[model samples]
Target: MDLLKSLLVSASGLKAQNGRMRIIAENVANANSTGRTPQDDPYRRKIATFRSHFDKELGAEKVELGKVARDESDFDTRYEPGHPAADANGYVKLPNVNTLIETVDMREAQRSYEANLNVIESTRTMLQRTIDILKS
Candidate 1:
């Protein structure tokens, strides 16, 4: 593939990974958050999705960030009688966001982002070398 198309592919990947990281960070930040009222639901974990499509402009497959989906899993409950959001049974609804899972997802997104960055760097280097060869 041409250098420009390679750069475009890498750029798309970088954008997708960056979006995934943002979603993971938001989940981590709200892990301990509880609802304001017993009837109110706590923060739900968000999942990041990606879609691959053929780009006519680039004439290659490119990845993009898809819709942010909600985690339909049940929320965790903690016994906290004194808590304002506690129910009659002294159970407070906690976010389903698991810190460990979020950490792992963040790490994976970071690695993917780094890989795309490396590809862009390599492509740039090759483009520069080609220019130098032509000028010599």
Candidate 2:
């Protein structure tokens, strides 16, 4: 029963990591995106938050994905006179996304996802072994 609970917990972790990876991917994909007009704002980087709460049925504190929040940091500006979205000063506002940061976040999320998968696999293997021993 505890093994099953661990499996569930790990599954929750995997789900959270999956959501995080998606956000990171979106940030990476929109790293070069700019606003349509000087008055408009480009894509803002999104961050994934996690929280743990007691599950009544499982009787355990399980992790879950929290709300996705936008990064409020200032956008990078570049001077490009010919750009359509350039401002009066020939400056264009770029998305707050940084590819390097997104890449690092993606790697971290991948590792966490793999770790959770490993836990699930290991639990299943042990459960199978226990059943085999009982049958013998």
Candidate 3:
């Protein structure tokens, strides 16, 4: 029963990490995305926050996505007067997404996801062994 509860908690973590990964992927995909018009703002970086909640059924704290927030930091300015999205002063606002930071976040999320998957695998193996022992 305890193992099952642990597995459930880990499953929640996996789900949360999966969501985080998706957001990271989206950020990477849109890193170079610019505004359609001069008045529009460029793409802002998205951040994922995780929170732990008590699960009565599992009797444990499980992780979940708290919020997907937009990074409010100012975008980088580039001198691209020829660009279509350039401002009147010949400056273009670049997206706030930093490829290096996103890549690191993605790697961390992938590792966390894999760790949760391993926990599920081990829990399932233990459960199967217990069932086998009881059958024998």
Q: Among these predicted structures, which one has the highest lDDT?
A: 1
Provide the TM-score for each candidate, comma-separated: 0.98, 0.97, 0.95
Q: What is the lDDT of residue 11 in candidate 3?
A: 92
Ranking by TM-score: 1, 2, 3
Cα lDDT tens digits, model 2, 19-98, are 89988888988999998888888899999999999999998878888999999999999999898899999999999988
Task: Please list the residue runs of candidate 1 whose C-alpha ends up more than 4 Å from where it truly belongs after superposition.
Answer: none
Q: Model 2: residues >4 Å from true position, as ranges?
A: none
Best by TM-score: 1
Window of ten residues with lowest summed lDDT in model 2: 59-68
* Model 2, TM vs. native: 0.97
CA lDDT, every prediction?
Answer: 0.97, 0.92, 0.93
Q: Itemize residue pairs with steric clashes in candidate 2.
A: none
- State the lDDT of candidate 3 residue by residue for 65-133, as single tens digits: 988999999998889899999999998888999999999999999999999999999999998999999
| Model 1 lDDT-worst window of ten | 32-41
Clashes of 3: 0
**Residue 10 error for model 1, in Å?**
0.4
| Per-model root-mean-square deviation over C-alphas | 0.6, 0.9, 1.2
